[model samples]
Target chain A: MIDKEQVHRVAHLARLELQPEEETQFEGQLNSILEYFEQLSELNTEDVAPTTRAIDVSNITRIDQLKSSPNREEILDCAPEREGDFFRVPKIMGEG
Target chain B: MVSIRDLHQQLINKDRSAIEIAQEALQRTKELEPKLRSFLRLTEEHALAQAKQVDAKISAGEDIGLLAGIPIGIKDNMCTQGIPTTCGSKILENFIPPFESTVTGRLAESGAVMVGKTNLDEFAMGSSTENSAYQVTANPWDLDRVPGGSSGGSAAAVAGGQCVVSLGSDTGGSIRQPAGLCGVVGLKPTYGLVSRYGLVAYASSLDQIGPFSRSVEDTAILLGAIAGYDPQDSTSLKVDVPDYTQYLKPDLKGVKVGVITETFGEGLDDEVKGVVETAIAQLKELGAEIQEISCPRFRYGLPTYYIIAPSEASANLARYDGVKYGFRKPDSNNLINMYTQTRAEGFGAEVKRRIMIGTYALSAGYYDAYYLKAQKVRTLIKQDFEAAFESVDVLVCPTSPTTAFKAGEKTDDPLSMYLSDLMTIPVNLAGLPGLSLPCGFDQKGLPIGLQIIGNVLREDQVLHTAYAYEQATQWHEKQPSL
Candidate 1:
């Protein structure tokens, strides 16, 4: 049974800011879903290996060579804020 | 409402110009747009330009591709170069992709004209397009009902005669469910059978791009254009791409069909079950050997998908912070605050809910109980398919539990909406190819789909079986009044 505090904690972890009413609503929704998920406890998967991917292909490496993109300006243009050639963001560190 | 083959023949015979065909499709789309709300953005200029190129090739006496001049809708989740690929979210509402997706890129290379970017549930999250931040795409058969989603617009466009065919990505039944509800042919190819490069990631392990069309033959033609290994997408399967159209035979002789016993009872609507059962009987009459096969772990697919998809989605969508492309909330004091506010303001409710669910499942003290357990259960489900296929060539079931429901019917209950994909989700878990085609209509005149699922990489068999059944039925011949 997840509570509003836990819902808020989950929302925070997901980098989402939920309103007070949304937290309460999600508390009910999440609990019902989680409770429904509890039905999986019936299956005994004690020795079963987890299937991360449906197909088994691995080590897909490409040659590490430097190649310049033709659309560098177009790529940079998609950024919300840019400083010349780089993406601009909020300050990460306090003023010394 | 012509098939791709007929349109292709018309172009070759010079009976219709590519520009004229494109114009007719665009004009029809405009007429249906007010009622269906199927497309997020119509690429009229780009479509006309592509049609002109095809016409130039025709005038030069060069052989054109099968898809040349065929108008098609693309689900906005795929990145189309220079086109706004919104994925039905406010976050990407203005985000124009700089590169093309592998599938759409291949489609364009085949000379298929891009009609527009169709709407979908935000980040392809919900079972219905109600979760779309832009607009809910209405079911073409009935105006008040929803076209099942998150590929609702793609399916609706094909059914409403807005486009001859379209492309949609399926993760947990997005393509098949909407195709079922909209009365069109939709296929979700085996995972890794189609490349995922430039497709905005939802659940990497489960996502697959496929075609939506009015006929199985058209679907086969579309599938052949896009299925192959690409150096860009490492997960793509390295196998010979067969000309899928060759496998479309009129008879199902020597085919062994399995009717999944678990899918018929309980929550399934009686009319849907009856329609699918009749379709199976028709398959048997077409000389298929029918057997009742039990995939016991089938019902567990929903909960397992909820855990696996959201966990991966939480990781995939983490890239949507305010610093990069897409919507950014202004005036944040710190880096973390910006990410929180941007995501909070930019994403719709269902997307946020899924992210939260995924975060909780993968968080500390809960990972072992939720995510790991779900993966282990997923192994059991895959084994169920493996064991069933040893005795059967293909599996048959209802694509969705019910026909299309009213637009706002399942909006308040997320779990109820999730149930819409119950029959289709397990196929994604096992990475199998599944195709949905119209079998019959319910008493309400809503369409019911018969799902034909094939073993991994056995798309030829799935198409063959669907083709046989489709040829024997008149359901595919009927189109919506719109």
Candidate 2:
């Protein structure tokens, strides 16, 4: 069974903040589901390559021509914070 | 009102105006939506505007293509320019897109009306609509039961007569399961057959947009309108887009139907199993040669899907860092704190759980033990399907193990809710085309779905066989007593 510490670690890694009760509940649920998933490790996969996509296609490229972008104002309108033609955010790299 | 063909003919003959139909559908939605709760946002202005455009085209004597002025419900996950596409989560609650999805774009070019944005499981993660952070879509057949989701609202809108057809995305039985429970026709076309350009990504490779409709012919017409190659989506197939309506004939004389053995065994409810068995016999009666086939790796599908979908979801949903769009928690010390709080507060429980599981599966030490192994097993499951298809033109099975359960019955136990898609997940795993139509009813009169799966790109055969069975049976004609 997974411990609360591990659950907290995973929640942090997933960028989610969980309360004490949620962490406990997650530990139980995750352990049960992960236990259910242990069955996959038992399968013989010695020579099988991983199948990432069901369809066989790759390197699909369009012509190297520029297309007009979508209405930028409409998209930028959804931003929570923004400056002149730029998305505003909490300080990054440099201190506020 | 039931037939898209008759509606289209009337529309062409000037017997009825698109505004008249749109107003009636709007009124019908106004009355039933309180009980059904199938929609997240009804696009009354947009739908009426599009109806006016169709009316203008008809008045000008210009030919409007298929699905002209047909009122259709769209799943909330598909982006509509300036319309809310929330994916049933608060994170994207107010995030309207600047552009349209390829499927909806195609629909608009074909002249269909966008009636509303339908409800769904959060980010298409759960089997029941209870996972929706907004509202639980009730099954029109039995208001106390779920419509079966994450396309529950799409199915309910079609079943409740609020729309003639609807579009839903299937990442695991999202379209087919709800359609089965709601007694409508839902088709998850072959993976690349439908483009996913502007769809809010759930699990990229497993996802495909398809149709939910009252009849097979309506489904075909809607499928034709929304399907075709789109350069916008990298995975969109370049194959010829067949006029699917041509395949709607009730003829399956030379078809070979394989009954999946894994679908019938333990865990399948007796009533559902009995309905599936009867549907199989009825198919045999319609000139389909039935054979019992084994897919040894089929049982592994549920676990494998749980791993792969969440793993992909973790990657896809990582973009929601509360940076540019959507919700942002006000109280946060730093950027990282803002991300954690925004996501933790914004996303629903199921979405967060899947994100956590995915993060754990794809985490450093466990990568080899979980994600990679699940992908390898996915191949084995695919191979099992490939072998089954070598002898059969189409595979027949139940869409769900049971009818729509009581609203909160499986919500607490996520595993039990996950089991609802048992019979339908293998199709997604294999990237095959699958169609589910009303086959029979359980003891309580809830509809049972008969799943017809075809090999990759063999949707014609799947539709042909379903059309035959649907024509043979009286099941699809029965409306909910609502």
Candidate 3:
């Protein structure tokens, strides 16, 4: 069974900061779900190929062409923080 | 609610103007909104405007489509230009999509009026609409019970006669489960049968857009309008769109129906089972050759879906990092902190739990044992369907194990909630077309659903069978008195 440390690690990887109570709640929840998933091991699929999609349509490509979007202003307007035409982000470079 | 064909007839025959119909729909929606809480945002002005356009065409002796001026609800997961397309999440609370999803685009082209955006489980994650950050949509049948979700609002809208028809996205039983609970007809068209372009992705492989209506004919009409090839979605099938209504014959003569034995076993509610069994008997009466087919790997759908859907969701939802559109938590000094805090603050508990589960499954050392293993089992599940279809034209089962449960019934126990989609998930996993139509009602007067699953791209067979059963039964004619 996974503990709080492992839950925290997974939460961090998913880019989610869990509250103390949420971490504890998820620990029990995840372990129960994972335990249910253990039933899959009963089937021997050594030679089985994994199915990624219901339909197998492969290598779908379109002609490379430049087409300007008509809603550029509307798209940029959806950003939470924008600087003129670009989206603004928090600092990436840390202080030395 | 009237059928789309009848509404179109009313418009063309000048018995009722499109504006009048739209107003009536909107008025009904307004009246029911307090009790049902189905819609997130109603586009009353836009719907009336679209209806006026259809009215103009009729006055000028111009041809109009079947869906012309029919008020419809859209699950907010699909992008709607200039509309707040929240996936029922706080993250996208203010995100107005600048574009239209292919399905909605097609519906607009067919002259369907956009009445509103419906609520859903946040990011289409939960079985019950309780996960919606906005509101928990109540079942129209029983105001205290949950309209099964994440397409609860869409199903409720259609079933409650708030709209003639509505669209929903099903990753795993999102459309069908709610359709069952709300006593509406819902279809999850074959994956790739309906284009996924502009749908807010939850699980890329599993997510599909479908219709919810009060009758099989309306479902077929809406499916015909939306099902086709599109260059925008690469996964869309490059196939001809058939007139799905042509297959809706009143007889299921010589049709092979398979009763999935695995679905009948443990945990299924006795009332639901009895109702489904009666529906199956009705199918036999319609000249269908019924046989019991065992898909041994069927029950594994829950675990397999939990892994695959979340794993893909983890990747698809990564785009929500504070850099792009959507809610971004402020006051973060660093980029990483911005992302973590944004997600933590924006997402609900269920969404966060899924993200964590997916992260762990796809993370280092667990990929082979979890995600890869689930995918392999998914193949076995597919093969089981393929084998069954070799002998049967369609498979039959209960759409949901039980009818609509009271809200907050399974909220605390996520596993119990996951069991709600047990029978329906395998259909999504196999990429098959599945539909749920009202079969009967339980002791509590809540509706039970009969699921009809078809082979890949064989929606014709599924619709035909459902049409036959629907014609014979009076279940679809009953609506809840609000």
Candidate 4:
């Protein structure tokens, strides 16, 4: 079973803040789910290549071209906290 | 629900004005919304105005195409300019997208009226619509039961006769599972066949947007309107788009249909299995040859999807960090605190759980063991499908192990909820096309779906086979008494 400490660390890395109750609840749920995944390990996968795309075509490119864009004011209007023309946020690179 | 062709004929004959049709649709929605809760936001004014525009065009003797004046639901994840595209999550609850998704944009151009945005699981994460942060959409067949999700609302809307047709995205059976449960025709076109430019990504590599309709013919009509190469979507295929309706052969003569053995055994409901087997037999009577085939590695699809989908979701959803758009914390001293608090307050439990799983799988020293291994298994599963398809033109299976369950039955157990898509996930993994249509009903009268799966880009064959079987059965005529 995955331990509580490991759950906390994974949640932190995912940028989520789990409540105490949620942390404990997830500890059990994630463990069982993880255990189910162990069934896949029984197969030998030597010399097999990973498939990122099912149909193999990749690196598709289009010529560089200019196109009309959404209005900037409308785009910034959805921001929760915004300055005159910029999205507002708490200061970074310094301790609170 | 009436077919799109009938609606078009009605409009052309001036039997009903577009405005009249739109009002009737809204009226029907109001009468049923309390029971189904299919829509998150109803675009009454927008729908009426668009209908009026179609009416004006027809009055001027202009061609407005097949979808003209038809009211339909757009799954909330697909963007609609000025409409709130929440993805059924608190994080995007207030996000009024400034642009239209390619699918909806094409539909609008075809003169289809947008009646509203349908509900879905938060970020399309869960198997049931109960995961929606706003409201749980109920199956029209039985109010106590779920409309299978994350496209549950879309499926429910069509099944409830709220709309002629609707759009839904399928990544690991989001569209097909719900379609199976709700007793509607749902199609997931080959990956990259329909552009994913405006779909809010759960798993970019797996997601494909398609339609839900009461008839397979309508499914073809709607799919044709939105499919084609899009410069905006880098992965959009450059292949020729055919009039899929022409491929609707009434008989599947000399067609080779494979019945997947792995999907039938263990944990599947006896009634569902019986219904699927009978449906396969019906296909044989329709002049198709049926073969029982084995894809030995097929059972691993569920685990592979769990890893690959979440890993991609973690990266795609990372953009919502309480910044440019979406919900944010009101009180936080620093940026780090704000990010954490906003995400904590905004995301639902299932979304958070997936993010954590993805993070764990992709973390340092574990990437090779989980995420990479899942991808390699994905390769094996794809090869298994390729090997099976060599002898069969198409494969058929049960869309879900059981019919729609009670709303809260599987909510407590995520793994059980994941099983609802077990038979459909491998199709997504292989990036193939699949169609789910009503085949029969369980003892309680809930709908059972028969899935017809085709090789990559072979949707035409899949549709033709489904059409033949559909013509031979009366299942599609059964509607929930809402």
Candidate 5:
């Protein structure tokens, strides 16, 4: 079962701020989702080998060749805030 | 009446001009645009100009490319040079792509006239078109109901006959589910079969572009045009793409078809199940052997997909800071506030929720428990197909649990919205090729799609079998009375 504290914790970890009402709502919803996932635990996966891929395909990387790309100015032109060659924004970390 | 082959015949016979078709398609778009809302942007002037070139080529007795002058719809997620590539998000409202995606470039080279970019769920994140920041695209079948999304507009355009075909990207049923709801053919080709260069990434590992068409032959023709190696998409396969249209004969004499047992559990409505069962019976009559197969790992597909998809989404969406290639807030005093306010104001609620969930799953301590663990689980799901495919050439199931639900019904419930793709998720997780085509309709007359999944790079066999069934049945001939 999920609690208000767990909801708050998950939300914070996700970088989302949740209100008290949201925490209550999430507690019930997350628990319902968790309860559904519990059905997966009953399967006998002990002797079963974990399969990673259906296709045996590998080496899908394309060659590193220089191609004409959108200009840096065109790319940076849409930035919400800019400082020369870099995007500028509020300080995310503590005072520097 | 305008099949790809027939259009080719017309172009070859000099009876009908490609310019006329383009002009007619443009006029039809003008009539339907306000009511359907399928397109986010239409490029009629450029389209007609391209059509004129194709017509001149025909007039001069010069060879034309396949899909020459065939009008098609492109999903908004695909980057079109000089066209807005919004991905149904307000964040990039004014952003126009300066470069063309490899897929779009290939289609353009083939002389396919793109009518416009179609609407979709925001960031291709939701199942219903209701999440679109621009406008809601209605199901052509029933106007009040949704055209299942994030490729809803693509499906609706094809189903509504706005275009003979359209392009869509499927990351966990984005293409197939919408097609299923709209009564059209949608193929989510094998992973890496088509280039992903400028197709906006939703869940990078799971996303691949495919075609939505009214017939399996049209789907194969489009697939042939788009499926090839590109130096731009790092994940694109380097293998030779076989011409899929040549393999459309309705004869699967000795083929083996497996019906996955796990997909038809308690969730599917009875009407949908009945339609699928009837299709299986018809396939048996067509000289193909059918069997019931169990892949126990499929049960875990939704959970694993939810974890991996959101985790990837969280990382991919991190680039949309207000300062870089998306919407920004003018009143922001500082950098952090700029990012926060821009994202908060720019992205829709669904996009933010997914980012948050994805962020949580990939967080420092939680990565091993959630993201890593889900990847490990994804391995098991892929293995399920590996073992099952060993005994069968292909697997078949219902594409979705039910037909199109009302647009806003599940938007409020994210988990229920996620369930809309339960059957198709495993195929994406396994990276196998899957196709969804109209098999029959539910009691309410909405389309029921039969999903045919084959081993990777076996799209030819998948299409062949589906085309065979589609020809044997009258289902594909039924069009929505819009």
Candidate 6:
């Protein structure tokens, strides 16, 4: 049913650290969910192309034009953190 | 007491100033906010200013849009320039957008006044508005029960009489489910009928910006204003945007309405089934032909939807890193921590859960097994509609399994929450249009929504069927006791 290793792997992939409290609950939940998904394994889709979009569209493009977008200041105004013209965030690479 | 048609008359006769109507709506919002919590942010100043501008235009004999002064609640997912487009998530609590979405921009251009941004599930991922990081929008009818989400606030706003209409995004029944729960008219147009330029993506292929209103006519009026081909949304179809309002009063004679026999079976509340069956009988009396249609693939709608929707959600939500817009974390030594901590702290539980599931589904070995497989199953579900529509003009079912439950009733149970949209998700998967209309009430007096499903571009039939049903029933006439 619920695979602890899969749950751990999923947590790692999603970048979420599951506390002990959540792990027990998630183990059962994720397994039940996977069991539901296993139902789809029965469907015959050897010839079907995956329907990525609901409607069919071909050559959906617009003329490339350099239209003036919101200025940099206006764009960055909504950012939670900023430095000069760029958005400032935690130094994601090296220790400061 | 006034439909949009009559309201237009009152406006034309100068019996009501746009400012007067707007102030009335704002006053109602103030009165209802304590109980309903329908709005995340109310744009009273902006709304009144827009109303005065409309009055000025009318006085100057300048042509005004049909909905020029009507106050409408916009679900928070649709970005409004200079307004916080939170999408009911804490991560974007202070994240105001610099640009308005195409749908909102279209409505603004067409003279629809924005009352405020309404609440929704975090990223429109849940059925109950309880998942909203900010607040839960109470159904105007009961005040204790939920207004179905992620468009709960929009539906509650319309149902509560705070606004004449509202805009909502439907991803796996967000619009229709809330509309059903709230006892109002909600339409999720064919996936590409309305542009998705500014509406925050939950499940890209399934998401659509639609209308929530008190009447079918109001829904049509609003849909007409917003529906059009937009080059901004690559997925938006270039197909002709029909004058949807023209189909408001279509001939119902010979209209083939199909009843999904399975939707009335187990899992549906007895009261809801009774209401849907009664609505069908009334539709049959309205000179429309009724037939029993079976869609077997609908049984797997949930599993297929979960896989495909989350897979897309995983890819779509990748933009919200600490480096870009919205919330960012503090100094971190590495990129992985930056991504993980920022997302973990910023996103709410439901969003994190979905992201986790999506990431897992798209991961290396699981990609073909989960995500790719789901897409294949999605086609079979779509084909089910293709075959069923051949014999029917529109498929009919209960919009939800039941009326709105108490707000906290299903919040802890994610599976129960997922099942809330069981009936509505298939239509989205098939890329067909569906509408939820007030058909009847339960024994507890809670409103029930009868769903009308139509083949691709058969919105005309859907609206007309709903209109005929509304015309024959007095259910929609009853409002909240407040």
- Where does candidate 6 stray beyond 4 Å? none
lDDT score, candidate 5, position B243: 82
Which residue runs of candidate 3 sit more than 4 Å off their true CA positions? A94-96
What stretches of model 2 exceed 4 Å from their correct place?
A93-96
Interface C-alpha root-mean-square deviation of candidate 3: 1.6
The global Cα lDDT (0 to 1) of model 1 is: 0.94
lDDT of 5 by residue, B458-477 (tens): 99889989999998999888
lDDT (10s digit) by residue, model 3, range B156-250: 99989999999999999999999999999999999999999999999999999999999999999999999999999989999999999999999
Clashing pairs in 6: none
Relative to the unseen true structure, what is the C-alpha lDDT of residue A12 in candidate 4, on a scale of 0 to 100?
Answer: 86
Write candidate 1's Cα lDDT for B1-482 as tens digits: 69888999999999999999999999999999999999999999999999999999999999999999999999999999999999999999889899999988898888999999999999999888999999989999999999999999999999999999999999999999999999999999999888999999999999999999999999999988999999899899888899999999999989999999999989999999988999999999999999999999999999999999999999999999967699999988778888899999999998988898999999999999999999999999999999999999999999999999998999999999999999999999999999999999999899999999999999999999999999999999998897
Give the per-residue lDDT of model 4 (tens digit) for B387-443. Answer: 999999999999999999998999899999998899999999999999999999998
Among all windows of 10 consecutive residues in model 1 chain B, the one with the lowest summed lDDT is: B330-339
lDDT of each: 0.94, 0.90, 0.94, 0.93, 0.84, 0.86
TM-score for each predicted model, relative to the true structure: 0.99, 0.98, 0.99, 0.99, 0.93, 0.97
Error of 6 at B179 (Å): 1.0
List candidate 4 stretches off by more than 4 Å: A66-68, A93-96
Q: Using lDDT as the measure, which candidate wins?
A: 1
Segments of candidate 5 deviating more than 4 angstroms: A1-31, A43-73, A81-96
Model 2, B1-482: lDDT tens digits are 36898889889999999999888888999899999999999999999999999999999999987689889999999999888889998999879888999888888878899889999999998888888999999999999999999999999999999999999999999999999999999999999999999999999989999999989989888887778788888988898989987887776788999999988999899999988898898888888899999998898999999999999999999999887899888757678878888999999989999999999999999889889998999999999999999999999889999899999998778788888888889889889999999998988989999999999999889889989998999998999977
Candidate 6 global lDDT = 0.86
User: Model 3: clashing residue pairs?
Assistant: none
Evaluate every candidate with DockQ and list the scores: 0.70, 0.65, 0.76, 0.77, 0.38, 0.62
Ranking of predictions according to lDDT: 1, 3, 4, 2, 6, 5
Q: Is the docking of candidate 6 incorrect, acceptable, medium or high quality?
A: medium
